[model samples]
Target: MDFGILGTLEARAEGRRLSIGGRRAQLAMAALLLRPGRVVPVDQLMAVLWEDWPPASARTQVSIVMSGLRRTFRAAGSESEIIETRDAGYRLRSERVRIDTLTAERRVTEARRAMREGRTVEAARGLRAALALWRGPVLGGLDVPGFAAPIRRWEELRWRMAEELAEAELALGHHHEQIGDLTSLVAEAPYNERVRALLMTALARAGRQADALAVYRDGRRVLDEELGLEPGRALRELHAAILRDDPAVGGPDGPARPAPGIRPAQLPQAVASFTGRRAEMDALDSLPPDRDRGSDRHLAICAITGVAGVGKTGLALHWAHRAATQFPDGQLYADLRGSRGEAGGDGPASANVVLQRFLRALGVATADIPDDPEEQAAMYRSLLQGRRMLVVLDDADSAAQVRPLLPGSHACCVVVTSRAPLEELIAHAGARPLPLAPLSRDAASELLRRVAGDALASASPAEIDHLAEHCGRLPLALRTAAARLAARPRPAGDGLPAPRHEASVEALEACGCG
Candidate 1:
């Protein structure tokens, strides 16, 4: 028997399926599927089923629905006590059942890790295996209350995985092979800057730089007419790079250049002693693909908004590194300098300037790009309308800054890291808001171990715990502290107290005040 919750809700036994009966039961299953193996309170379940108001016999109805689901699982040959009643409410025992969602996630995660390690062949294989698991729109047959969020989330993941798979192919130099899929993706998400960017890259790589530049122009028009926004910095830079034929910027012939002001999404190799954030890592990993399939001009944006040093960039980069393969055309990252700058004119790079650079990277000529910010944006978007790419915009100050940079289509996915909550993006643009918090106690400790190694292993567990707490479990703070310790001249054999533990603790405590 197989129980799949990755894409859609399904229970099948030897090719035969078990029915969920009604929308209520389906909704219950969907809710459980959203957070498998975790106990969901009955009240929460009721809210999911009825939205605002529950019927008088909500509890009794829930019990009855759960009982039916349990029976269905049994009849479907799932003998591992699929659902168990708990003091809190109910917990689903998913052991021994084949869950497509879990399987897909595992496959994609493995692929991401492989790509990080430079194991391109293995990453490609893993991505293909993961993509093969999708049957249809996840939970396609089920219509239930509270299903929208999970469903959309799953679909987003699916597309993201597909994008990664395509990227892996691109890394293997399979540009022409990906053209078909890229075409469809571009058609579906016409406004996705990343997608258009990738398409341009692919075209350039396939010996069609002219076609690539043309794609950017088309995308530019769409953005101007529809959303009144311009292409982002990455796209513009790509165009310029292409025009200059800059081999250093990951263009056709030169050494692969890293995006300007863009650091790797993952921790630097210099800071190996990192710890905690398994859940955050998982959440980052679990972030669904862009979920705008209906409109060709769909723009899927995920804004990681939080306070300073909460590890927004860390989480974003980690996931981006893992997901780089999905955007085979290329991975583009930019730091908007939203957080750091002085009063002088030498402030963080502007959106228009960034766009210009991105366009060059994709093969746009400098002269072809206009001087006016609006025209530059339009030209930049036109260059990126039909590709599969991942664009990370870090430290955005406001939606206005980000709005102009959003791609004109959904063929690409954009991850924006910001300190403030972008309500307009979420409410108006369907951008999912992922609020990053501090690491959990365990995650914080693990981070410390990764960084400091056995040096801190023998230290008092309580003290270590206090230390993690003192850092507020923020990845940046923890990293900074760990870096300071690692830089010490003392040998590892020396039994030295963790330097600046008290000071670090005090600083962390102060962070809480803000």
Candidate 2:
């Protein structure tokens, strides 16, 4: 079935436009589409329709609307088969439904790949195609409450894509052709320095040098008048270059020009809600600063070892993001799963595979990578010999798996996160062992409040501590227990939110933990 929620809320089953009736029908459809292949509770559906003031007959009304939607689909020959009524609520059975926003995001991913491969023109074209999916205001006129957030997010993504496309176009001297479009964009986002910078560059490239300088003056005045600040470093540098007519400003050999530097910024996106690990972050930051050991041997290696669910990888990633500026070249990451727990899923990644990836990130050709493991390790170290870089080896099951991948150069910093303490890596390689433990009592409480809303706000301080103890102060376990307590239905006839103590008790009893 073709789903067209990007603009109008419409679905086509078997090539025919299935007619949807009224506002209630649209709301119901929107709710289902928000989470396809899952049941949306009837009460949750009622809340979405009439938030704070639900009628006494709200349940009956929800039933009526659902029945009407089923009849509408059945008449269209889609037959209520697509919408199944589960014990909790209604479920949309179609997993094959196509959503336009998902399509656009996939295209954005493709464009990112093109940029990585030095295909900026193709990246620009791909971005334009992705932005072309929107017909008008997304989810327009539906009035689906809480739907605005996702729409706003998508619109933000579209604007970012446009900015990226403009960047690529300007790099390829598509500046003259895009000045008009950019002018309108600058008017809309008056304070966006990037847009203004590109516009100035475009004007300068078009031989309107005076206009380009004037743009910088106008932008400076606007920033002082409104934001009480100056244009940022990039914009300021561009202005200086335009004034001096530096050949590099809008030249084909401008900024972001590919170089042979082996900066491997491959660290995965950091966890947004990473709670607390201040001491560990500081320890990793202070990686035993290189001393004059009478030799140039000073590679700072921090091995973060902990039990399962102790958040070793999470801490490593969060700190890596904070410490990214220190390693300007790049941050390389790999999951070296050693010690096969079974026949699959736990085996260590071979050193050759990891070196191949590292070598490529360092701009080495495939044919140039050495075949022997020792040779690969030697070449990897040689490339990183004099450069400052950060390498993260995560989930390493054993020491042997990590030995061959360590850089011999002291200029780099390597962070290894593992469950077992790789004693050999420490004894032989001088890795600083930072043993991570479960979250403390206070931090665990903060995490519970973060996950389960303000349930812990008015509860007894003692109660919060007791709940944390019940979960052994483990973040994963506390989150699970808090989730159940939060989902409990409020007590009958009490309008105000109830205390979490009773809910926690109920959760404990139901858990049946020995």
Worst 10 contiguous positions by lDDT, candidate 2: 250-259
Score residue 141 of candidate 2 by CA lDDT: 82
Candidate 1 C-alpha lDDT tens digits along 308-403:
878788778777776777765666677787866532444455787677667656655432444467876787576566666778888887777777
Q: After superposing candidate 2 on the true structure, give the runs of residues whose Cα lies further than 4 Å from its correct spot.
A: 14-16, 37-39, 251-514
Steric clash pairs (candidate 2): 263-329, 263-330, 264-330, 264-331, 265-331, 298-410
Would you list the C-alpha lDDT of every candidate in the order shown? Answer: 0.72, 0.75
lDDT of candidate 2 vs native? 0.75
lDDT of 1 at 386: 68
Stretches of model 1 off by over 4 angstroms after superposition: 6-8, 141-145, 248-514
On lDDT, the leading prediction is 2
lDDT of 1: 0.72
Best by TM-score: 1
